[model samples]
Target: MAVEKFETSLKKLEEVVKKLEGGELSLEDSLKAFEEGVRQAAFCNKKLNEAEQRVEMLLKQKDGSFGKVPFRLDDE
Candidate 1:
């Protein structure tokens, strides 16, 4: 799958949803929009997950140094 920037994908997905909800397109067009919207949503979700993982890996050292630490949801 081609990678799309999260912001761009999200904006496109929003436009697709607006078009779909407007009920102005033929069934075929609506289907196409829905498919593209799905793909965009998936891309946005993937990017968010990756960012969350990166944030979780970050650690602040006692001397104000930065380090890497495994992320743990339960520890929070």
Candidate 2:
């Protein structure tokens, strides 16, 4: 799939895992599915990491109060 949203990528990753566990695909097909799954997993991990950074920033505000804070990922 092309650049999917985080939820969509996670759902596709789950589907990929199910297909691999079912053991019905040929070796080549299984490898392809595994590669897709890896991509999705990496996307999800990056998203989660960005979110964690945002939360940490919010918690570290100088006023010692938890509140919404604007965030920008370094690479963005």
Candidate 3:
């Protein structure tokens, strides 16, 4: 599947998991699905991180004003 968007990629990953669980595919096909699933999962994770950063940059400060702040994962 050509994963053009995060939602599409996530849905593809779910389908891969279902196919793998069904135990109908051969070893080589199963391996291919697993690899694709890994790629899709990484893509979804990266998109989520980007969205979180955007939200963090728009956070309201203590002074009741919005400001762009560098988002640091370690701060969590």
Candidate 4:
């Protein structure tokens, strides 16, 4: 779909899901839609990881300034 980023892809996927949920598409089309959704899900997961790392790097300390912090997976 040539999305600029994972968030864009995820939004597109959400739209697709809404359309499919409307019960208007054929079975084959729905299957293809689901496959694309899986790919988008994976991309979103990767983007989430990268975003978490960036957030950790920019975390503010008690001094009201940014400081480096460990990127813990559970932080999200």
Candidate topping lDDT: 3
Candidate 2 lDDT over residue span 1-76, tens digit each: 3445888989999999999999999999999999999999999998877644333345556877686667677997
Q: Please list all clashing residue pairs in model 2, or write none if there are none.
A: none
Arrange candidates by lDDT, highest first: which order?
A: 3, 2, 1, 4
Residue 33, model 4: Cα distance from true site in angstroms: 0.5
Q: List the residue pairs that clash in candidate 3.
A: none
lDDT of 3: 0.85
* Count of clashing pairs, candidate 3: 0
Model 4 CA lDDT for position 14: 97
Measured against the true structure, the TM-scores of the candidates, in listed sequence, are 0.63, 0.63, 0.63, 0.58
- For candidate 2, the TM-score is 0.63
What are the candidates' C-alpha RMSDs? Answer: 6.0, 9.5, 7.5, 7.6
